[model samples]
Target: MNKSYDLIAVSPHPDDAEIGCGGTLALLSEMGYRIAIVDLTNGEPTPFNDNPQVRIDESLKAANILGIERVTLDLPNRELLDNIEARMKLAKVFRKMRPKIVIGMQGMTPKASPDHYQSQLIFDASVFYSRLSKWEHLFDGMKPWRIHHIFYYYTARELFTQAQPMQFTINISKHFETKKKALLAYESQFRAHPSYNPPIIEWIEGMGRYFGSLVGCAYAEIFYGSTILELNLFKQILG
Candidate 1:
């Protein structure tokens, strides 16, 4: 039997999850969740961050900093939509990973990038596809995989907020610094340009603190989910 993962973070852009949910991922991984990451794009042809191979290297660096096994689709930089072809390709990943939980990046909708839109499609599709009684080929008959939960992390600042309605607010103060360290691994992206980069890691820490303040912690990782989280008798949200 495949060892089920406790959480999976899906990111459309290179630094997105690192910015948005890095604290959560770090905390979960530390809590012994078999965390996995899927990056849909390779960060190529970017105006300031070009270089395909270089981008992949930097992504791997960031993943290593988080100690995550990242699966990059290596799709085109700014385009990752779904048609028969993209869905079919993603189906292959769903077949292989068999994640028990999935998370995706959120969007402002109609005002998001094609990559973000496609990532959302992939999120919903993969969640459904994993649980189907009959998927279209590539595997044996009646291979069904149901994920226990789905989360969409903030990416589109317009719709999601630094102080938005959150499904679950996890305290990741201990791991916030860890997340910052991992984000710094992607130096070529955030530390590369003159006018582009924000103090990526510090900025994320500040966001964490803001969310943490909402829940009486020094840091928190906000999450939006599809289903009501299962809370144990201890009142901690069950993984």
Candidate 2:
């Protein structure tokens, strides 16, 4: 029997999903939604860390912190590309897991890892490829599954913002601390290590606060989607 998920987040690496949408994931899981994060790579061989298992362990810890499942693929870390192999691997997951919603990382990070941009391309393709009819042989004969909704999360690594057609923020006031704790679980990446020593936690908090202020909340996370969003305007405005 195949496993199922209500939502699956595609991350270029372990910490991306945590940094981008941990609060939202936590809130949704609390609401009894089946959510998971799929890391495209182990995110190893960085300046500070050489051990891949450490990163893997950190990712699992973060997943536990946010009450979500995690899956790490065997793709290359820094050398990730939007090729057939990568697309098929992710599409296969979409087929097997059968998520109704898929959230992916958006934007190109020139200063950061190029894998982010490649991840975006790969994610877009996998969503399409996952629903193809005659790709049974490539995906080990798994049935094609069409995801119902698509959303994009930002890493906040870019210096400038790219205007998206459908952008919105979710109130994460109650779950902001959960998101912070999850990101802190990635000690190898955020802590004062050999080389990577940035005020990531502080930065993330600031970003969350800024976005929250725009929506009159204590904390919030931003997301982009192509699908039209339908909501009760009066309830939102009065709340």
lDDT score, candidate 2 = 0.90
Candidate 2, which segments miss by more than 4 Å at Cα?
Answer: 232-239
lDDT of 2 by residue, 116-220 (tens): 989989999999999999879988999899987999997786634567889899899999999999988888889847245577888899999999999899899
Q: Each prediction's Cα lDDT score? A: 0.71, 0.90
RMSD each, Å: 3.6, 1.7
Best by lDDT: 2
- List candidate 1 segments past 4 Å from native: 109-112, 139-142, 159-166, 230-239
lDDT of 1 at 142: 30
Inter-residue clash pairs, candidate 2: none
